[model samples]
Target: MFDCIDWVNLPTFFSMLVARSTIAPVLAAATETEPEAESSVVLAGVLLSLVAIYFASKIGGEICARINLPPVLGDLVGGVVVGISALNLLVFPDSGALGSDSLIMSILQSTSSLTPEALQVTFEAQSEVISVLSELGVVILLFEIGLESELSELIKYGPQAAIVAVVGVVLPFTLGTMGLIAFFGVATIPAIFAGAALTATSIGITAKVLAEIGRLSSKEGQIIIGAAVLDDVLGIIILAVVASLVKTGEIEVMNIIYLTISAGAFLVGTIVLGRLLGPYFVALVKELKTRGPLLISALIFAFLLSYVAAAIQLEAILGAFAAGLVLGETEIQEELEKQVIPISDMLVPIFFVVVGARTDLAVLDPTVPSNRAGLAIAAFLIVVAIVGKVVTGFTVFGQPDIKRLGIGVGMIPRGEVGLVFAGVGAASGVLSDSLQAAVIVMVILTTFIAPPWLRIVFNDSDRLETVQEE
Candidate 1:
C-alpha cells in the first residue's frame, strides 16, 4: 500500500527535485548577491541569439536567391521561420525543425548551458537576451541602408530628384489620403494608413532597374535616383506628421511646419558640418583599428537622428537614411562601404523576409468581403503606385536628351526600403493587415514590372554609352 502511494506521487517527487535544484542560485542571483552567476548566464544567452540571427539570416538569404527572390525576402522569412524553430529548439531539443540543437550551440545558450538546478534561471535569462539580440538585428539592418547611398550622383541630380521625390511622395499621399476619406469612408487612422502606403519607395530597386537597361547614367536616371533619395527623407517627415496627427487628435500646423523645417535644417547642417569634419572623423575611425568605433559612432549618429525623427513622429529609419546621405559625401565612404556592405548585404534580406512572413494570406480569406476589399485595394494601389512613378518620367521636362520615361519606369521597383516601410508600419500597428498586404503587393508589382518595361523603353544599346560620354 505504501509502495503504491509512492508510485502515485512520482510526478510530485520529480517536480520538487527540479524545483529544489534551481531555486537557491536563482534566488541568490535575483537578490544580486550572486552577480557572477547571473552575468555569466545573461551574457551567454545574448551571444547565442545574436549568432543565430546572423547565421540564419545568411542561410535564408542564399536559399531565397536559389528560388528567384531577393535575399532580403529570405532573411526576413528566415528570421521568423528560424526564430520560431530556434525557440522550439530552446524549449524542446528534439522538436525536429532541424537536426538536434548542436552541442556547440547549446554551450553558448544560457538555457542549454545550465544543468540540474540552474535550468529555469538560464531560461529566464535567455528570453531577455533574445529580445535584445533581435533589436540589435534591426539596428544593423537600418545601418546597412545608410551605407548603400551615392552622394555625388544624388547631388548632381538634386533639383530634379527633389522635384520627383516631392511630386512622388506628395501626390500619392494626397491621392491616397483623399481616396480613403472620400471613397472608402474610412476614419483618420485608416486615411493615414493610406498615405503611409503612398510613402513607400524602394531606392535600390529603382537604381537596379535603370542599370539593367543601361540608363542609370542618363539625365533622367540621375534625376530619378536623386529625387527618390530625397523623396524618402520627405516621405518620412510626412509620415511622422500624419502619425502624430492621428495619435494626438490635433494636426498642429505650426508643429508640422517646425518638423519640416527641422528636417531640412538637419540635412543642410549635416552636409556642411560633415564635409568640414569628414577628414577627422575618417582618421579617427582608422585609428580605432578594428574597434569598430566608426561603425559604432555611425550607429550613435543614426540613433540620435532616429530619436529626433521619432520625437517629431518619424520612423527612426528616416533618421538613419538622412545620416547615410551625409556620410556618403564624407571621406569615410570607401572604408565604411568596405567594412559594412557585407553585413548589410546579409541582414537586409532578413528585413525583407519579415515583410513577407508577416503577410499571412490566410487573413484574407478567399471567400470573404475583407479578402475582396483587400484585392480591390491592392489593384487600385498597383495602378496608383505605377502611374505615380511613371509620371516622374516627365521630370526631365527641361532635358529631352534623356529617356525620362525609361528612368521613370526604372524608378518603379519598391525593393528593400519599400518593404521596410511596409514591415515597420505593420509591426508598429500603424497599418491594418489588409492595408499592409495591399502596399506590399503594389511594391512587388512595381519592382517586377520595371525590369521588362525598361527594356522596352530604352531599347537602344548605343544610347547607354553615349549618355555616359555626354
Candidate 2:
C-alpha cells in the first residue's frame, strides 16, 4: 500500500506542512521589525536636517561676518534660503507643509524603502524633533546670557528696566490694536491679537547681537536685557488673556492673575533660592570625578528649572535664564562660562536658523491677490512696531547719555516671539488670512531690520562716545 501511494511523494507532502507551520512566526517577526525600520528612517531624516541647518548657519554666518553684519543675521538668512520660502529643504508640519513639500523627504524617499504613509509619519516626527532641539537651543542661549550678565547690575537697573517693559507693552499694544480697528477695519479679537503680537521683544536676538559686539555688559545692555526679560513676562500674560478671549470669547481673570503671580514668583524665587543653593551646587559638582562634572551638573540644574518653568505654564527659557543668574553668582562662574561656549556654538545657531526657516517670505509676495491688503496692513504694523518700542527708550528717566536709540532698536526685533502670537491667533481662527500675513511680515521685517539697525545705532554711539572722550 505504501509503494502504491508513492514513497517519494510523502516527503514533499511533509515539507509543505512544515512550511505552513513557520509562516505565522515569520510574518509576526516582520510586523515587529517594521517599527524599528520606521524609527531608523526618522533618525536619518533628522540627521540630514541638522546637516542642512549647520551648513546654512555657517555659510550665512560667514557671509554676514564678512560684510560687517551680525553673523546671527546670516544664520537667519541661511534659514530663509533653505526653508519653506526658498529651497524647501527644511520644511515643518506646523507651517502647513506636506511631506511631499520637503526636498529632504524626497531625498529620503528616493534613497530608502519608505512608502507614502511612512514618509508622512517620518516627516512629522523629524520636524517635531528639530523643533524641540531648537527650543532647547534657545534655553541654552538664555542660560549663557545669564552667566555673562551681572545680576547686581540687572537689579540696580531693574526699575528703569521695568518702566521700559511697561511702556514697550502698552504703547505697541495700544497703537497696533487701535490702528487695525480704525484703519484696517479688522475685528476686535484679531486686532487685539495683532496688538499683543507687537508687544514682544526677542531678547535672544538682541542679546546675541550685544554679545557679538562686546556690549553685553554695558549699562545700556544691562537695562536692555532686564527690560527684555520683563517684557517676556508681560507678553506671556497678554498672550494668555488674548488666547483665552479667542477660545471662550471672554477674559479669564483668575488665569491672568495666576500667570502674573506665578511668573513673578518663579523669577524671584528661582533667583533667591538658586543663590542660596549655589555654593552647595558648586560643592556637589566639585565632588564628582567625571570629565565634565561642572558642565554636566550645571546643565542638569538648568534643565530641571526649565522643566519646572514649563510645568507652571511659563517659558522654559526664563527658568534657564534664572538658573544662569543663580550660578553666575557662584565661584566657578567663569570656568562654567568657558565650558558652555562650545555647547552654545553648536546649538544656538539651530534656534536662529529654525526661526528663520519657519518664517515664510511668500506672505510678503504682493503678486498674490490676497497679499495686497496684507502688505498695506503690514506697512502700518511695521511702523507701529518700530515706533511703539522706540519710544520706550525715551521713557528711561534717569539714564542720561544712555544709548536710547540703541535700546529702542534692540527691542524692535519680535523674532520668534511674535511668531508664537501669530501661530496662536491662526490656530484659534481669530486671525484672518490678511491679518496673519500682516503679522508675519511685521515680524520678518523687524527681525531682519533690527539686527543691522541696532548694530548701526551702537556703532554710531561708539563713534560719538569716542569723539566725546577725545
TM-score of each: 0.65, 0.93
Q: Per-residue alpha-carbon lDDT of model 2 for 1-470, expressed as tens digits?
A: 56577577889988888998899789988887564337888899999999999999999999999999999999999999999999999999988999999999999999998887778888999999999899999999999999999999999999999999999999999999999999879999999999999999999999999999999999889999999999999999999999999889999999999999999999999988888888899889999997999999999999999999999999999999999999999999999999999999989999999999999999988899999999999999999999999998888878887989888888999999999999998988899999999999999999999999989999988898899999
The regions of model 2 sitting more than 4 angstroms off are: 1-37
Best by TM-score: 2
Instruction: Kindly list the per-residue Cα lDDT of model 1 for residues 33-72, writing each as its tens digit.
Output: 4323357665765565456556766787688557544454
- Lowest lDDT sum, 10 consecutive residues, model 1, at 91-100
Which residue runs does candidate 1 get wrong by more than 4 Å?
A: 1-150, 178-189, 204-222, 248-250, 283-315, 322-327, 330-332, 401-406, 409-470
* Residue pairs in clash, model 1: 21-117, 72-349, 75-350, 76-350, 76-353, 76-354, 77-353, 161-227
lDDT of 1 at 423: 58
Estimate candidate 2's RMSD in Å. 5.8
